[model samples]
Target: MNHFPPLRLLVTFEALSRHGSMRDAAARLNVTQPAVSQAIKALEDYIGVRLIDRSVRPSRMTEEGELLARAVREGLGRISATLEDIRAMQTDADRQITVACTLGVATYWLMPRLSGFYDRHPEITVNVQAPASDLPVLSPGVDIALRYGTGGWREGINGKLFDEIVCPVGSPDLVARLMEDGVDLDTAPLIHVRNPHNQHWAGWEDYLAVKGITRPRSSGQSFNNYVQAMQAVIDGRGLMLGWRSITERAVLEGTLTEWPNGTHDLGTAYYVSTGVDPSKDALLFTQWLREEAT
Candidate 1:
């Protein structure tokens, strides 16, 4: 390996790039502004390139400086992430299972039913993670994942949770008004959920096409996630495609009303998948999930 700048100097430079001002970086690192400037100078001397362009009022990064800053930022980020993962793996090994699922499933389906699991196995803890992608996969540090689709996943041991039944649902008032007006699916204000990661799920176009109905040029409001769309539906904004696992409880509780004639089987189902080397605790929780789904 070649000679490199000190870790402290690189850290200071990284802070300077992030905060965009020596004073701010100094305050963040709990040091004087002159100390921040000195660290940047030391880093530049070691790298043999002008990192900060002090010619400007606020002190901007040169082209090389920008490139170095990006590298440092990514490098430090990865290091921090890896360290956290390592610590989690060490501490979370005993009696803990990390389950990843979509936000909709986590919020509406899994969370409402977790009390039973805890009741049965008080010694074990289940950690639920809802990734921003809205799609859950068996990833590192994640013991199990609840995935929704027609089962073709080749990653780990897969178990069927339940077959997905997607139906259009709306508030009770909206459903009553629409029914009274004799408004069918074609003319009703339909809330749509669309996101890049939601490809596994059905959208308005798919649902309409399946029912042989054509949506008009003007459509309803669009949201990126199910939570927001469901909120709109609850508020009587429009109808939304509701999955059986997510909306069944709400429907039963009268929070939302489903159109009996609008139900469709999209041939998709939810599956619980475990990592290649799943922990015993993960298997235990997976069994509970199967029992609940059944």
Candidate 2:
């Protein structure tokens, strides 16, 4: 519907105009002088304009060529500017990130502290995903993963967020009742978290084994994830192994109570993982996370 010279012809003409010589334009465009001359000839034929004054010694642009050069320079400059604006918009879109973590960690730890991140970086939006498998993986579309482990993940750039401290926790009322009844820590009804995808998680058996106490498997009830287990513990159903990072707020708020002398260092910590070529927004978020953990 519209008639226009080939973009290559226009580009060659522009280069020739800017450099004032076909040889210089060829060097700038990495083309032979003949190719540059041919492109200009093609453009001239297409536009029916004598753009170059061959009568000059070094070959100069004619009056009409000077006008076309101005239009071409302005058009190309605007195109470059619009391209940069599109790139900026793409960078802004990248500010929205997806973080993977356990349900309990998302519910208790990350969600509560996210307000601080939003306050610091209003432009960044964090989308938290709790994997069905308690372990978080840096899968495709996942920007960052808040993983709990001893920190040897082969996935991405891994950094320990903070040390993990485990302890027995129950509802305040249940804890009070158990203490009043003089129930031993090991003998308390334990709430267990178990799943096929669960790796590196300390269960009731592992915790009891660490304390040199053995209990029957029937001594506790099991849940697929920490969220359900924590709710049951809060409802005074039983005591669950609580990670300090996840349950510290609940204990502080008096919704949950920790047993005295129950804390243990399991030699594990929460780590943040991001792809090697992380986006600027992802780097900002990880930095914020490290600051928060500190």
TM-scores, one per candidate:
0.69, 0.67
Q: What tens-digit string does per-residue lDDT give for candidate 2 at 1-294? A: 168888899899889989988889999999999999899999999989899999969778899999999999999989989999899878877678999998888999999999999999998889999988777898998999999889888878999999999999999999999999999866898898888888568887788889888779778889888888888999999999999988999999999999888999999999999999999999999999999899
Q: Poorest 10 consecutive residues of model 1 by lDDT?
A: 193-202
Which segments of candidate 2 are over 4 A away from where they belong?
1-92
lDDT of 1 at 97: 82
Whole-model Cα lDDT of every candidate shown, in order = 0.90, 0.90
**Going through the candidates in order, what is the number of backbone clashes in each?**
0, 0
The TM-score obtained by model 2 is 0.67
Worst 10 residues of 2 by lDDT: 199-208
